[model samples]
Target: MPRLADKRRAILRGALTVFAREGYTRASIDQIAREAGVSTRTIYNHVADKSALFETVIQESAARVAEAQVEAMDRHLGGAVPDLREALVAFARDHARPTDADHFALVRQIQAEVGHIPEAALDSWQDTGPRRVQRAVEAHLARFMAEGRLRTADPHRAARHLVLLAAGEVTSRSFHGALPLPAKEVDAIVEDGVEVFLRAYAP
Candidate 1:
């Protein structure tokens, strides 16, 4: 018999697939159960309702992605950055694309169904994922400012700008990773973005 935790994970993964493919408006518990290889009754045993399930799936998925992003931030900016531009470029490249294809598919679905999604779910997603990653970058940027590697500026704003400039172009151009861009193109975008960021925040 599968462990309870394994069943729960299977349910979430199956729910994510359905939600990503069908959006919240069209996904059904029956469909999720089929995808998850579980009985409908089993899903009900775990979640109160569809709304609760969606909330849980998105928050869990976001946390997984954010964990990777925070690690990328630390890898790129956690130590002495001899070349800020190079460091930013590397970080941006590392994070420029979706590491988890299924998660981004859900993200695309969320964007499409934002108007219909529960407010709490959306808020939880942001807090669990993007905001957490932003805070990590903000902390690193603050340290850079203190080190005089970057000109003194609003760390929060600088972090936002850095993310937008560094990774936004690729994400936007790729349509949230639905369309893949070439490596050279991705590198070009990251390089240009890092250059623009360095110019804006030069000491």
Candidate 2:
């Protein structure tokens, strides 16, 4: 038998895929349970309701993306880049891959369905929502600032721009129904962005 925690994780992952392919209003717990390979009762035992499960899945996804992004950002910090542009190339290339890109899709899904959810769901969604991803970027940038690799006057504000330049652009592309840009193109964008950012923000 699978461990309860492991089973719950499976269910959450399955539910997230379904929720992304569908939406909160249309997604069914029965489908989620089926995808999770657990009975409906088991899903309920693990989560309060569909909304609760959605919140959990979304937060978990956010956490996953945060870890990867923070790690990738650190790679640029320690390397001997000729200038900010080279450092940014690595930064953008790191995110250009398809790994866990679904989390961002989940973020878009939440924005689409937030109004339909209850106050509790809304609160959970907002607190650990895509907003936390922004905070994570801030924390990572602050680390670079502490190491003297970055010269931002305010890490928090600067992080907001970085997040917008990176993830925000990808998120915006969805609005236009455009496919994800190539990884190399993303690197160029980041390289250019870093150049511009350094003009005003870097020390």
Per-candidate TM equals 0.97, 0.78
RMSD of each: 1.1, 3.3
**Candidate 2 lDDT tens digits, 45-142:** 88888878987887777667666766776677544545655666566556544466466566566678778866766666556644665665577667
* lDDT for position 141 in model 1: 91
lDDT of 1: 0.92
**Model 2 C-alpha lDDT versus the unseen true structure:** 0.69
Clashes of each: 0, 0
RMSD in angstroms between candidate 1 and the native structure over all alpha carbons = 1.1
- Candidate 1 lDDT score at position 152: 98
Best candidate (score: lDDT)? 1
What is the C-alpha lDDT profile of model 1 across 120-179, one tens digit per residue? 999999999999999999999999999999999999999989889988989988987889
Q: With candidate 1 superimposed using the best TM-score fit, by how many Å does residue 139's alpha carbon deviate from the native?
A: 0.5
Which residue pairs show collisions in model 1?
Answer: none
Off by over 4 Å in 1: none
Give candidate 2's TM-score: 0.78
